[model samples]
Target: MADRETPGDAARSDRRPLDGIVVLDITRVVAGPFCAMLLADLGASVIKVEHPDDPDYARGFPPMVGGGDAGESAFFTQFNRNKRGISVNLKSPDGKELLKQLVRKADVLVENFRPGTMDKLGLGYDELRRCNPRLVYTAISGFGRTGPNSSRPAFDNTGQAVGGLWSMNGYADRPPVRVGTIIGDLAASLYATIGTLAALRTAEKTGEGQVVDVSQQDSILTLTENAVVRYTTRGEVASPLGNDHPFVRPYGQFPCKDGYVFFGGYTDKFWRLTCEMFGEPEVADDPEIDTMDKRFDPDVAERRVKPLLERWFSAYGKAELEAMAGDRVPLSAIKTIPEVVEDPHVAARNMIVEVPVGGETVRMVGSPIKLSMTGEIPLGAAPAPGQHTRSVLAELLGLDDEAIRRLAGSGAI
Candidate 1:
């Protein structure tokens, strides 16, 4: 926290959600970064700790438009926004001492290091908890902290596979597919954030802290949805059902004149409205497709509804069909990234933001969490590697210019 007049001052002046909270973020890549990012968004002072020799692996990932010494990638920038970075060589004794100093002040400490990595680094939960008994320590792994597969290295791909998400996607005949994005990592991060916040609240009440164990594998299992329920109730291994749902009729994407428009007439009334709106009320009442039971019948809906829906959507343009669909049915005019950027609804919602980077303005998504009292902090472009190292150390750690230069010279910052 800074003095009474600084930006950090305003950030910590009053309890704006998680204000007065301090987090020492030791995570890397998506899962860890995402958890810390959420805390930062909610008003925690998040200090992202990285190694001095190497930075976050995401910093080197490609699609690097601006050339720099750190090779900071766009991926890193997106997830790591609204965080201050510090470099510490945790392998060194002096670095570990520095980390202990940080841990002493942190209300929460989050790490995604594999099972015993932190223990090896001598910053295990048991050790850190001794330093600050009120610290909420969170660990995110591929499997979990305990289990047969606990020690095995896991990433987003492994989580998706074992968690049954991959099995439930794509066409039945085709092989299981990893989702287009890091769904497993994001899921684990979300769970981690939830656990951290809950623990923080509890600690505030009890004056004690606990560990939060979030497994990517377990988080992906959440996506299994009814798969587990069906299996437990009646021994069944569900297969991928393609574009159509196993239990909903006329509830998927249909072709349009230019592109695809997704419509989910998932109920009897929506089905009726969809049919009448598309000038085909006959399909809505037909015994073969009217009831939920028959609508989920793949062979029946494929034969009867697919062709008719296609023709109807083709007859009307995407916009007209969208207008007709209206709020009567769950519908979306399948938009591309650029279309979403330009969409009036998205703009009105303040989803897109223009951030300053040098003299240029970079376009990105603003924080989604809106506060009624204190608003979300306006974000700037991602910091350059160690961009805030000197300033943060001098301000937060009370290190002067000579001390910083000494730490940097020793390669132990």
Candidate 2:
């Protein structure tokens, strides 16, 4: 995949692997926008298509770049970076025909509408494939294209609740909490990106494109891990452990003098090292919990290991404890948002990037996918509504100024 070539590789204007590919992003909010942004970062020419009059609601998301309601959404700016923007009235006949025209030249089309909305507009995958046989049709939905719940409109929290993720998140006694982040949308977006690239590869190889259906609920269900397997294999309905692992002892977050530190001294070797680091080497030789298997017993863990670790951990600060543990025990300070943004390790990895927007700079998390050839992905400011409509229409569809003016007049651009 890293070496795959496309039409304009001879010029090598963009050294990224996805150069010469074009993507039509017919999506809003999180999941779909994130998928398209990944493609854009990889050097694909992504055109974000929103409704002309009522554009993506994310444009109003707050903490606006220039402050108040005067400027663009910083939230929108982060996800939509490195993409051109267009607006189309998909409800109109002219808009439908215009989208079809753009489809013929596009390598991929990504949409996050409800199951049948595209079909109602007559721009569904079945219809679009007729316009371009090699176009990858990527769809992200709540439950999926085929299911009893397929038609339901879902947001991030909805996906988490329905997919059983919310039930497993918090302490067993307390009401469950949704994952701190928008894992439902983000996980689905990651899966959609993987599916799109795979389908794109098949399109290039066999000259045939296919549908990529990613459901947020399905994505969440896939991440349930040991809970699902435990139920199936042992009929054990897992309950929340409140930062505790199912089998490992001394492996969860512990309070230090200031802030918290995650400590993993479960393995016998690491446990011994941790004991030595605390100047309690005799504790490591305790016959009652000498081996890792013995330490897993509830009685031993509850009465012995937990108290020992907690007593030691409470005496030192997070950074001091982590430094003492070093590479011997897997220990690290739990960082806050500000701490993470200023982290030396994150800076060294180029994980945080700044994008210039409307004379202001919005700092954003950078793409994690790094290729040796494409060392750094250039960030483009998030576009105003329909900002690139005329350019995209003229370049891709070969529409002249008169035609562009007519489309704009009809509110179909």
Candidate 3:
């Protein structure tokens, strides 16, 4: 794999899809911040707002680089890059007014607070839409805004369980498991981003903005399609398959000499190819497993097909098998992080990126979206608390030094 910079100058250097857009990010932790981060990556001028006394709780997350508040949490840096930082004490009257002014000017506002928190602050969508008719107001929460459980506090794991992912994600004999990554939060963030963008476009055309209510549970539920359909349509409640797919046999991971490879040679055509590759051509023509439906049957797969595949798979190492399979077989050796970093495909596509944090360069995952015209600009560092506070207030609200000093003295900023 070749390592290189993100492409930005190949097309129009001055043009970006969201170049003139302004995003106000009043969010904390994973889901909401990640949604704003994606917009910032697309060239929106995003202002990340935090409370003056208590900053984003994620800043204190682990793997701290020990530069005080400037570059403290690597975790926070991963999600909050490419944003301007400002602090405002929302509980204060002056701070509330300042945020209202920002709302009037922003094209989009994203928040992940509990359902009624903003309403209690008098900064809810109802009040804010009065000031800016074209504001795209988006809220990401554990439950929906109007649901019975909307006011209850929830986290990623809560969303997973409530959304039905946790119940069907593990082996039948063991306790249910959450997915390896924070898929609950990640899924919600993706939906929130899509909803916000859709609303922003409609606002531009109609001269009206609408509320985008994205619930973590609702987002995750969409991903549970297969399981939900099985129960509702067939009266069959699907449990965990333990590396096996619901119907496909010989289609999951198998151990090799060095590591494992996921093989999808389940259909009749691919099954014949797999048998030929395994030097067992006779097995491919066997009457019991000749058809795709017969091979897909659970009992037949366990009784006959699995033993033959496992026996063949154990003789080859990952790289040797990959070299022999070429592109004909639907197979891949799972890559470790080191292997992924050095991979030619990843490097050629610039899938691993470096952004500066303090004096050091930190590597993070790159954006997956690759538009011909929208190759990314270089990523910016996450900010210290209120790093652009005075400048942003002055620039956006026309506040001079005396006014900023008074607000600061009053603990409003």
Highest-scoring model, lDDT: 2
TM-score of each: 0.91, 0.95, 0.95
lDDT of 3 by residue, 221-288 (tens): 89886988889999988777678899878799888889988889988888898888878888888999
Q: What is the C-alpha lDDT of each candidate?
A: 0.82, 0.90, 0.87
Candidate 2 lDDT, 183-261, residue by residue in tens: 9999999999999999999999999999999999999999887888889999987666788888888688888899888
- Say which candidate scores most in TM-score: 2
- Candidate 1 stretches with Cα past 4 Å from truth are 1-15, 68-71, 357-359, 401-406
Name the candidate, 1 or 3, with the larger TM-score value.
3
In candidate 3, list every pair of residues with a backbone clash. 1-343, 1-344
Measured on C-alpha atoms, candidate 3 has an lDDT of 0.87
**lDDT score for candidate 2 against the true structure:** 0.90
Count of backbone clashes for each model? 1, 1, 2
For candidate 1, write residues 344-411 as lDDT tens digits.
98886678877654345567776777654565466756666566788777766788999888888877
Q: List CA RMSD, all candidates.
A: 5.5, 4.3, 2.7
| lDDT (C-alpha) at residue 344 in model 3 | 86
